[model samples]
Target: MKTLTKEMQAAITPDMALDLLKQGNARFVNNLKINRNLLQQANETSDGQHPFAVILSCIDSRTSAELIFDQGLGDIFSVRVAGNIINEDILGSMEFGCKVAGSKIIVVLGHTKCGAIKGACDHVEMGNLTALLTKIRPAVDEELTITENRNSSNPEFVEKVSEINVKRTVRSIVERSPILRDMIKAGEIQIVGGIHDITTGVVQFHEVESL
Candidate 1:
């Protein structure tokens, strides 16, 4: 309901940040969103922002992290890419968000029925996008359970690969960024994964913690 401030951000622990996200998503799914004046939040955060978490999610039009999490402006830092894949640039941004900007949590958010995951499952290629989808290919290969219908059309295969991709991305963040890893090791931050079901408007987080 209120915009996140410097003191509020500093007071929140990593686990508490994750819990806040879970509670926000629950409010979203149940249509119990809190009322906040966007203009007031925008003005409050105009000079600076002290977001508590950094969310890496998909470019899917339906999976906007703020909307689903019911967060006001300056509540969290959002980074988006197809398949929620990780790269050097993403790692740097996350490092800045946590190490420099003081965010307490890093979330690699994948979504069900993701088009990028589907493309990776089928190896869809195009200008620029081919390279982007290639990052998700490893997850597709790692999903050895669904060997029968290995394409995107098979809902099961897509779902498995999507979850795998999120987990892999979570691992990648910790392994690729020493700043983030050190922060996590020092108990200053946490990295986790989740999947957003498009139909249900629900974000089901994975139990595994990549700290």
Candidate 2:
């Protein structure tokens, strides 16, 4: 596969961009990686980059978006943070990725057994991490189904909070950034959420929710 050019990126619809990720993840799960020359891609994208998607995922070592999505150089813009939490800076980055950089889709990717979600579940605090984990507390609050073990020790609760955090981050991206929101309304971009199964290496994308 060749690197995406300006016209190629422009030709891709929001839905098509999402399909590309789905196909990539399928390849990753099955170990059917497409052959591509990384050096050639590096040179091809040297002057400019026309990535089709912007993925915001956790900073976990196991959940590298590019590797899990099986994308080559310049295929996507990756924005990672613990818990995949949304903040002013993340919002601005998404706006730049879509409105300025012409990316077709924005993905908030959470993962099962995420450390950040686990920390939020237990209310663990330590310096700056405390503030960062606080951003995910709302997701824990939103999860009302788990009444018994509402802590990270329970695998079920951790996964539930992780999904909720991804959805919340997706909502925040659309609602917080007018540039991205306007672009979504104009049919230029789509924002979606997903969860990566650490054990299985499968990314389950949620239904697209643009604007």
TM-score of each: 0.98, 0.98
Best by lDDT: 2
TM accuracy, model 1: 0.98
lDDT accuracy of residue 94 in candidate 2: 81
lDDT of each: 0.92, 0.92
Candidate no. 2 TM-score: 0.98
Instruction: Give a tens-digit lDDT track for model 2, residues 56-85.
Output: 999999999999999999999999999999
Give the Å error, residue 139, model 1. Answer: 0.5
- Residue-pair clashes per candidate: 0, 0
Q: lDDT tens string, model 1, 161-206? A: 9999998888888887888888889899988899999999999988
- Residue 59, model 2: lDDT of 94
